[model samples]
Target: MKTDVTPATVRDWFSEQPAGKLFTMPTISAIFGVAPGDERRRLAEAVRCGYLCGFLERTETASGRAYRVSGKGMRRPTLEEGDRARRKAEARLARDDRKRRARGAPVSPNKSSRVRAARVSLRAANMPVPATAVQHSVCETVEQFLARGGRVQRLTAHWEQMEQAA
Candidate 1:
C-alpha cells in the first residue's frame, strides 16, 4: 500500500471517474495508487463497502461488481461494424475449413467421431492406443464368466488397465 487509503480519497476517485467508462475492482484500486500486493484484498473490501462511491453495482454477465459512470452502459454496436465483424469471422472460418479439407482430416460429427479425433491426436503424439471396444459379462454369473467366457472381464478391469499403463 502506498499510503493509508481513507474514505475521502476513495470519494475523490469516484468523483473523478469518466462519464461513459466502467472499471473493475483492481482498476479502481490501482487508480488510488495502491499496489496489487498483500494489501489488495483490503482495498477490495474497502471499495465494496465504500457506501459513498456511486454506481458500484454488479453487471448481470459480469463476475464481480463493475463501476459504471455513464447512463447504464448500453454498448450498442453500429450496424456497419456488426456486418463487417460477421463477414470477417465467416471468411476466417471458411479458410480454416479449406485447410482442414486440404489436410484430409475427417470432420467430427458425433460422439464416436470425437473419440476418433482424440485417438488420432494421441497417435500423432506417439502415445499408446487403447482398445477399441471390450465385452463385459452382462447376464452370466462371475464363476461362469471366469470359466466359460474367453476373455471377458469385470468392469473393474479399467482400474487394472490404468495401473498397467502407469
Candidate 2:
C-alpha cells in the first residue's frame, strides 16, 4: 500500500473485490491505510481516474455516495482510446471557446489587454468611443431610478407644452 496508488492499481483492486460491493471514501481510505486528510488526495485521484476509465461506477445510496466495480470488463484502456478521449476533450474546449467568442465574451486572460483590444476594434469599426463620465453618471441615475420603481414615459406632444412652460 504505497502512497502513490495508480488508477491501474485501483482498477485491479476493485476487480478482485466482490461485484456490487459499495465503498465509501472513508472505507476506501481505511482499506488503503491513508488518512482522510491531505494524505488521502492521492487515493482520491486514483479513485477519480478509475471512475473516468470506466472501471468504477458511482451511485447514490441511502448512506451517501458510493463507488462499486463497474463489472463491465477488467481490461485496461488502450492507448488509442486515451488519445481519442484527449482529442475529444480538446475539441470540446475549442468549441466552447468559439461559442464564447461568438457571444462577445472576452478571450484574453488579461483585463487591460481585453480593454485595449475592444478599444482597438471599436476604432477600426468607426464605432463611438466609450462613454464619458457624465454619460456614465446619467446611466447610473437612470438605473437607480428604475431600481426605485420609477417609470420613464415618452413625452410625445407634451414636449412642446414643457418647452412653453420653461
What is the alpha-carbon lDDT for the whole of candidate 2? 0.79
Model 2 worst lDDT window (10 residues) = 132-141
Clashes per candidate, residues 3 or more apart or on different chains: 0, 0
Query: Model 1 Cα displacement at 7 (Å)?
Result: 2.5
TM-score of candidate 2 on Cα atoms, chains taken together:
0.45
For candidate 1, lDDT tens digit of each residue in 1-166? Answer: 2666744455456657776566777677776677777567667665554533343444443656676543332234224768969998989988887788789985436687788889998888896668788786678776786798657644758879899899
Q: Identify the runs in model 1 with alpha carbons over 4 angstroms from their true place.
A: 1-3, 51-55, 60-64, 69-166
In order of appearance, the predictions have TM-scores of 0.32, 0.45
Candidate closest to the true structure, highest lDDT: 2
Compose the digit string of candidate 2's lDDT tens values, residues 33-103. Answer: 88767668878888887787677899988877799998776356545768979998989988987888899
RMSD of each: 22.7, 18.1
Badly placed stretches (over 4 Å) of model 2 are 74-166
